[model samples]
Target: MATPHTIAVAGKGGVGKTTTCGMIIDYLCSKKTGPVLVVDADANSNLNEVLGVEVETSLGAIREEMAQAELKGTIPSGMTKADYADFKFSSAIVEEDEFDLLVMGRTQGKGCYCYVNGVLKSQVDKYAKNYSYIVMDNEAGLEHVARGTLPHVDTMLLISDCSRRGVQAAARIAEMIGEMELKPGKMGIIINRAPNGELDSGVKAEIGKHGLELLGVLPQDEAVYRCDCDGEPSSKLPQSNPVKQALKGIMQELGL
Candidate 1:
């Protein structure tokens, strides 16, 4: 088990990916075992909402400086861009109980974020080594890591709704993974908002074609919706909630 250092959660929008990520974080925190780092790589910035953290810092500002550093080549002679990039990591990290979070807010311009996002890759890769588990709430797609921004992860959880579009999106993401050659330890599907029953024939077949393990499914739960409306943290979801129980199955299946 190659350390299982980092886990990236990705999927189509409205797939409850962020909520799933939060549940994973909750599971990690329950253990008296290790530190958990939550990385929010979504431009929409909802991981903070799921985790119930009012984010005060983000990777955006440091990206501005790294952009300047890369363009000017003024990072103290002999230090590689990656070496100078470490400082940005220290400054960018935001710590909290049981973990820290690094939120990648929106990118402003049309130009690429190559300079800083590149630096972020190595920085996060190094930071990952220190912890037992790292949970990333990735974007709608995985273009960031595919383009070499976020670090190589262990398991990539592509959460999807129980819909044809979700199934198709999962297939496309698997293709993207191959094209990028980001050989994660494993990749799988977490079907959210699906009824707890035998997998639908078409759904099983679609998932089969991709060779992705059906990690688990979270049935539609009003607990989630009601709580969300009230701004309650997913991690603190009541034990009676079906969503929490479903997520427990997910983590157990993954051996988290």
Candidate 2:
């Protein structure tokens, strides 16, 4: 089977990265470029909240359980430890009509996470080919990508919130990706929640200095905030919402 076109979204917190990731998934599914796999690789996973989906389990939660079981030497009869772990991992994938979400629930603590991350990478590698698009909403930084725990990325979209610090944070992520030599097919910076889906000269200059391409700007829309406040799905935003429209343009520019 052919591999899916993977798009990984990364940025500092509070930059609207998760919301934009949701928008990318929504846009792709709307275009019938599914079945899309949405990986909430963020430790503080809230992608489901934005998508209005429920998750019963997460990779981290089950990893802890399996590891503890192994420590206690309680691998069930007739089932290898690997098989039991795989079963739990499969259950972590929450199915939805338009997409499937696999969340990396909590932050890693002390001790090596190699075994769990290894299983995650193995499972992702195994199942990724079934989808046409895999959109990963990563954590605030480049930890997962830098560790090389996830599947290969086709494109990486770095998001900023039209602030100088936010842009610099995105630039740092881009720099880290370069230093690590992950070499995604396409990499670009997106200015999110901008005043009018437009960037001023100063922000453009800052982005240029980092050698990052400005794919497009997403305008601020109060409707998005209202939805968040009301605990509603971002995908439920009206077609006329500026943020939604801007994201559509951005996706088009990226040729997604």
Candidate 3:
């Protein structure tokens, strides 16, 4: 087994970050790059929905169950606590044709997530070598990265809408990544939902001010909007669809 290339897509909410991640996974599968491991590190945990997959459980849910079961001494008679946890963790991964989805669900009535996070990190480390690429859709902020919930990123794609505030938020995340010394091989910003696939001059200026690499701009496509409205996976968008095409081009530019 070889090390996998990990790509992390991050942005503020409502910026189409998850949708972009779905498309990236679709593109990699379409190209027959290799098996992809998709981790939804977002607490909102809608990556499965965007990918048209049903998730029966999440790591957080499993963690909570393990904690309760331990308190109640409900571990199976033969299996040790570690074995039971491994069983539950394996069950949380939703396997798909092209990729496997692991969602980090929200904690409920939690004391802290430190234990579960360790479990997730170990699982991810164990499973990572089997895939050629690992793509993660992260939470709005850097909580996942700061907490070391996921693997080191190879490429970091920061997403932003055509707004100054969105860019500013992305810039702050980029800054935090630098301060944390993640040192991703490639880091850039994708301006999504740009009208007519064009960036506002002010937005360009903002990007310049922050010194963020402009990876590409994705147009606001009606097809994508309609797919979301219909609860269809954006990956189902046709290749000729503007959003899909634009993203494909960007990925090509990145040599993915």
lDDT of 2 by residue, 212-250 (tens): 899889888888888899999987677677888888987
Q: State the lDDT of candidate 3 residue by residue for 1-256, as single tens digits.
A: 6999999987888998999999999999999979999988887789887789999889989888988999999989899988998898999888888899888886688447666667777888988999999999988875867776657789999999999999999999898888775778889999999999999999999999999999999999998898889999888777898998999999999999
The global C-alpha lDDT for each of the candidates, from Candidate 1 onward, is: 0.77, 0.85, 0.89
Worst 10 residues of 3 by lDDT: 110-119
Q: lDDT tens string, model 1, 1-256?
A: 2243688887888888898888888878886468887888877778878788888656766676777788887678888876776666587777888788887665567756665566566667767767788898877877685686767778888888887678789878867876775777878887887776245678877788777778877787777877689998877787667878877877777777
For model 2, the stretches where C-alpha displacement exceeds 4 angstroms are: 107-112
Q: What residue pairs are clashing in model 1?
A: none
As for TM-score, the candidate ahead, 1 or 3, is 3
What's the ranking of the predictions by lDDT, best on top? 3, 2, 1
TM-score for each candidate, following the candidate numbering = 0.85, 0.94, 0.96
As for candidate 2, its clashing pairs are none
Best by TM-score: 3
Give model 1's TM-score versus the native structure: 0.85
Q: lDDT at 53 for candidate 1?
A: 80
